[model samples]
Target: MSEDPSLHQSHPDIIKRLKRADGHLKSVIEMIEAGRPCLDIAQQLHAVEKAIGQAKKTLIQDHLDHCLEDVVGPLPSDRRRTIDEFKEITKYL
Candidate 1:
């Protein structure tokens, strides 16, 4: 597993987003159990989805910006390796 090099900076923000999503997800579960309207449940679900998606995007981009630089340094060969690795990772997104 790859570790986040900018964990000090990005991890807090990512965790905050995920926590918000977790809260929204819990609300969604409650809404379903309480037989809430479909529209309200859908909206809460969308919020949870967006929060998670944004967190994932932020993490990947942060890794691309900070971690890649830290791991690859300034070497041209290492730069190619970073680019290749990034390309592979982006395929999942």
Candidate 2:
């Protein structure tokens, strides 16, 4: 199998954003433990979900630009598989 060129090419900004989101998630957990207001906890959870969606969008864009382009041409099976995987991912969104 050929090495994937985009495997380790994630942008640092994405990593930073993910780290911040992780911190937010931890804070949410702490809020729950501390018996914070239910509405406030729900708001934090919603924010985390939005952050995760944004991160997914960024990753999907990178995949389209790099990994998908690499496997799309001259390989019908690979192309179809990639399309199927993307469709599956969209179901979760």
Candidate 3:
């Protein structure tokens, strides 16, 4: 991490997305306890899964674009280091 204290520009949106997904997940649990139809449960689960996936992807892409750039962009001479950094970041995806 960054020594900077502020959240990244996209972080608020991601947090909102995750919170929405969390609500969806809680509803999913309720639906299951109530013995909802499988198709409906599956659809809600899919939505929750997709929301989380999108949030994760956005965070990683934002990190790669801004954070990694801040860390590596200054060292134009270090090709190998930049490549390694990119590789390291993508490992999570």
Instruction: Kindly list the per-residue Cα lDDT of model 3 for residues 1-93, writing each as its tens digit.
Output: 455745688888999999999999999999999999999999999999999999999888877777767766665556857666775777577
Using TM-score as the measure, name the better of candidate 1 and candidate 2. Answer: 1
What's the count of clashing pairs in each model shown?
A: 0, 0, 0
Sliding window of 10 residues with minimal summed lDDT for model 3: 71-80
lDDT, ranked from best to worst: 3, 1, 2
lDDT of each: 0.83, 0.77, 0.85
Local error of candidate 1 at residue 2 (angstroms): 17
Model 2 error, position 7 (Å): 4.2
Q: How far is candidate 3 from the true structure (C-alpha RMSD, Å)?
A: 4.1
**Which sequence of candidate numbers ranks them by TM-score, best first?**
3, 1, 2
Candidate 1 vs 2: which has more lDDT: 1
Candidate with top TM-score is 3
Could you tell me the C-alpha RMSD of candidate 1 in Å? 4.9
Give TM-scores for every candidate, taking all chains together and pairing residue i with residue i: 0.72, 0.66, 0.75
